[model samples]
Target: MSNLIRLIIGFALVGAAVALFIFGHWGWGLLAVFFSICLFVTYFYNENMLIAQWYLRKDNMDKAAVFLGRITNYETQLNRMQHGYFNLLIGLIESRTAPMKSEKYFKAALNLGLHMDHNIALAKLSLAGIAMAKRNKREAQMYLADAKKADKNKLLADQIKQMKDQLGMLDRQTQVRYSHR
Candidate 1:
């Protein structure tokens, strides 16, 4: 189900729980509350992710960050796939501000297993960008290769080609500089 639908259902459950409590049905009210809490835990990360993506699509980085930040202790609350996506979201957002920190998040997401070729490719491509920025040509090349392999849909073809061209240029420049010395 969509996050919006889940959120509506959760709110309904909470409202019903409150109504039941007010009517003095203690047992049913407590049961409703328990179910509502479970639903909240399930939907919290999903809803935040949806909102964060919307903000990101609008280029509202600050707003996106705020929404993403609302998903606290996600490692425990979320399932494996969600946990991986949570880290991926954090990595993508943080890569703009704190690059070094983003690397760890990306790696964590990868280790947790994204389970999608596109997502895995994206993470690897981001790692390649990080490696390139740090002037680690070999590491960048490794990541680029992995990204290419993981991109079964060829969604990252343009980016892979661009990075390859950049790496080639860097290699030529390095060779020329060394030869002139």
Candidate 2:
């Protein structure tokens, strides 16, 4: 459902709740208020994305992908803030099968902007990994630096350290090739 429709439904429920209260149906008014809150929550969080995230937490990409795929047109279905997240989820799922292809999605996610610092760090880290895979050491280094900066809570500290180690290995590999030449 579109975010606008959900907002309208939420307002309608609020009206119903007000009506019930005025009619002395306190219990039904409370129920209507609860349902309205749920609708408002979905307006921001997006039901399909929430389900997909749940599956992702379980490391079930296939199921997660299915739920993500349900949002045929995310621009209409999701809130403005959720645009980045939707792309981020797609990128993560695609990375498992096609790491290179996922790069665009990651870029889109970054461009659209995410709400959380950790998610921003995750996207940058993923981009750094992609750059490393492509043997673009300079690009990888930049992304790693950005990822480190974005990871304000140290949530990706271990992964950032590991990536830096791998980048050092890249440096060694190049040195070895130069020595052989």
Candidate 3:
């Protein structure tokens, strides 16, 4: 349906431009046609980006990666597509059973050359979570602190604060238990 609408609108604009040229209003018609073309291109790119993001968020990492890879090929100059690719890599990392593979994905995301605040924060948080899982308190704290510094969302800020507090408590508990041994 949307494709049909786009087709209709495209033809309508072209027809209007032709009509205007025939009626001696060529300048306005040409401008309208140019603007319409620009609008269509922008909309197409944004729609593809949104689809990539949706697939990534849904945990369909393979599909998301494919889509994002296609987008990157289609728009070589668009850095935002790398953001989508990084997010898919993050998802892939989170799904891995092995810490080494997970770390690889996290590092791959970092190497993507795109550093939106949220994406960077998410990568840091993922690393922090992995550190916590491995009982590496110092590494977790470092990642958590980086995540906190990269925070763009106040809610995420609060969540990170709570996570740090929980991690601290866990560390204290571990120390106490080991000390009693």
Candidate 4:
């Protein structure tokens, strides 16, 4: 549903609740108010994306992708603030099956901009990993630095450390390859 339509429905429900209150229909008024709040909630949290994130947490990428697929045109279905999150979820689900293909989604998510610093960090970390796989050490290091900066709460401290360690291994492999000459 479009954000405008959701807003309209929320307003309509609130209007109905007011009319019910005026008529002393207390129970119906309360119910209408509850539904109105739910409609408003969709502005910040799209149901499809929320369910997809839940499936992701459960380690069920198939189910997560299915839910994300429901949003045919995310621009129309999700609010501006939610656009970044929608892309982030898609990137996460795709990363499980198609690691390289997920790079674009992660890039889009970063471009769209997530509100949470931790989410930004996760996307950067994923990008760093992708770059490392492609043997782009400089790009990977840059992304790792950005990811470290964005991870303000230390939520991704372990992952960041691990990535650095992997970079060290890459150095060792390079040294061995050069020493063979």
Task: Report the number of the highest-TM-score candidate.
Answer: 2
Candidate that scores best on lDDT: 2
lDDT tens digits, residue span 1-181, model 4: 7778899999999999999999999999999999999999876799888889999999998998899999999887887888888988988888888989999999999999899999999999999999999999999999999999999999999999999999999989999999999
lDDT of 1: 0.87
Residue 150 deviation, candidate 2, in Å? 0.6
Candidate 2 lDDT, tens digit per residue, 27-48?
9999999999999999889899
Lowest lDDT 10-residue stretch of candidate 1: 72-81
lDDT for each residue of candidate 3 in 1-181, tens digit (9 for 90 to 100): 2444665777788888889889999898998698668556644444555566787679676676565565454334344545544443545535554554576567666666445787778777777877887788999999998888888775478668877987989889999999999
Work out candidate 3's RMSD over C-alphas.
Answer: 6.9
Error of 1 at 113 (Å): 1.2
Worst 10 residues of 4 by lDDT: 41-50
lDDT of 1 by residue, 1-181 (tens): 5556677888898999999999999899999889888777656547778788788879888999998888777765555578888888889899889987899999999998888898999999999989988889999999999999999999999999999999899889999999999
Candidates sorted by lDDT, best first: 2, 4, 1, 3
By TM-score, highest first, what's the ranking? 2, 4, 1, 3
Superposed Cα deviation of residue 94, candidate 1 (Å): 1.1
TM-score of each: 0.74, 0.92, 0.59, 0.90
- What ranges in model 4 sit over 4 Å off? 19-27
